[model samples]
Target chain A: AKSVSISVEGMTCSSCVQSIEQHLGKMNGIHNIKVSLEDKNAVVIYDSKLQTPVTLQEAICDMGFDATLAD
Target chain B: LQKHEFFVDMTCEGCSNAVTRVLHRLGGVNFDIDLPNKKVYIDSEHNVDTLLETLKKTGKNASYLGEKSAQ
Candidate 1:
């Protein structure tokens, strides 16, 4: 599993956190996910062979959120 | 009884889209959404409490910023 972290903007409460999580959780090959509203970031674990950071970013975008892969 | 504004936590264009989608799903309520400002204006005659709870269930935090009489 490959782990990647991305910064997210505009999360104000726990519900916002839950929304992002619910959307991302539906994607295939996503092993685990954690989102912090206070920190404005999300960490995702996935299979590199089956998925990539770009794919994750697109998923986030599709759900109406911004995500940039952490350096 | 009135219109209200909320400062929504949205990250990008996608986030705005998601917020709009959720609000639109609520039957019989009208919403004026501003993506750039991350805000929503709702006009409804239904119970505000029900509306607020629906927003929360969709992963958005909404605060009552008072109301204005319908013009």
Candidate 2:
């Protein structure tokens, strides 16, 4: 598995963090996810052959937050 | 433009903000977020499917509550 950290914007509460975690957690390639509202980012672990950092970032973006890959 | 009523599972300011951002990003849409009621009323040229799909992108549970008015 590969891990990626994505910077997320516009979340205001713990519910926001939970929502992202719940939604992305159900995806096919994702193994685990941790969303931090305080840190304004999501760290995701996934199958490298099945997902890319860009795809993860875009998935978060599609969920209405401004998401970008974090080095 | 037509007004459509949608029920989105919004629990707090963050949820409502997510709704706001997605609708705004879709463009050509004017909307009101009733966070307490978990309702979103959108005035747009987009079809019901398009609007609903857009709302679902927020990773919230969203359902169409039918049309409201023609404005």
Candidate 3:
């Protein structure tokens, strides 16, 4: 598994954080997720073969938050 | 433009924020989010399917509740 950090925005509270984690967690490749509302970022661990930084970022973006892979 | 009512399972401010962002990102929408009621009323030129798809991006269960008369 590989860990990636994604910058997330527009989260105003814990519910936003939980939604990102819950949605991403259900995906096939994602193994773990931690969303920080104060930090405005998500750290995700996933199977390298099944997911990529871009895909992880896009998954979160798909959930309506602005997400980008951290450099 | 038509007014559409939709049910979104928004439980908190963050959930509502996600709705606001997705609709704003999709553009051509003027929406009102009622978090307490888990409802969203939107005025838009987009089709119901498109709007529902956009709302679902928030990772919330969203379904169209039919159109509302334009005021």
Choose the strongest candidate by DockQ.
2
In model 2 chain B, which range of ten residues has the least summed lDDT? B62-71
lDDT of 1 at B11: 52
* Residue A13 displacement in candidate 1 (angstroms): 1.0
Worst 10 residues of 1 chain A by lDDT: A58-67
Name the top lDDT candidate: 2
Chain B TM-score by candidate, in order shown: 0.69, 0.92, 0.91
Cα displacement (Å) at residue B11, model 2:
1.2
Q: Residue A11 error for model 3, in Å?
A: 1.9
Summarize candidate 1's per-residue lDDT along A1-71 as a digit string, tens digits.
99989888656666667788976787788899999887888999998987899888766654445567777
lDDT of 3 by residue, A28-58 (tens): 9888999999889999999999999998888
Q: Across residues B1-71, which tens digit of lDDT does each residue of candidate 1 receive?
A: 56866666655554565666556656677877776776667887667776666555434455666575656
RMSD of each: 8.0, 1.7, 2.0
- Model 1 stretches with alpha carbons more than 4 Å out: B1-31, B34-71
Clash pairs (backbone) in predicted model 3: none
TM-score of each: 0.54, 0.91, 0.84
**Which pairs of residues clash in candidate 1, taking residues 3 or more apart in a chain or in different chains?**
A64-B14, A64-B15, A65-B15
**Model 1 residue A67 distance off true place after TM-score fit, in angstroms:** 1.4
Candidate 1, residue A45: the lDDT equals 95
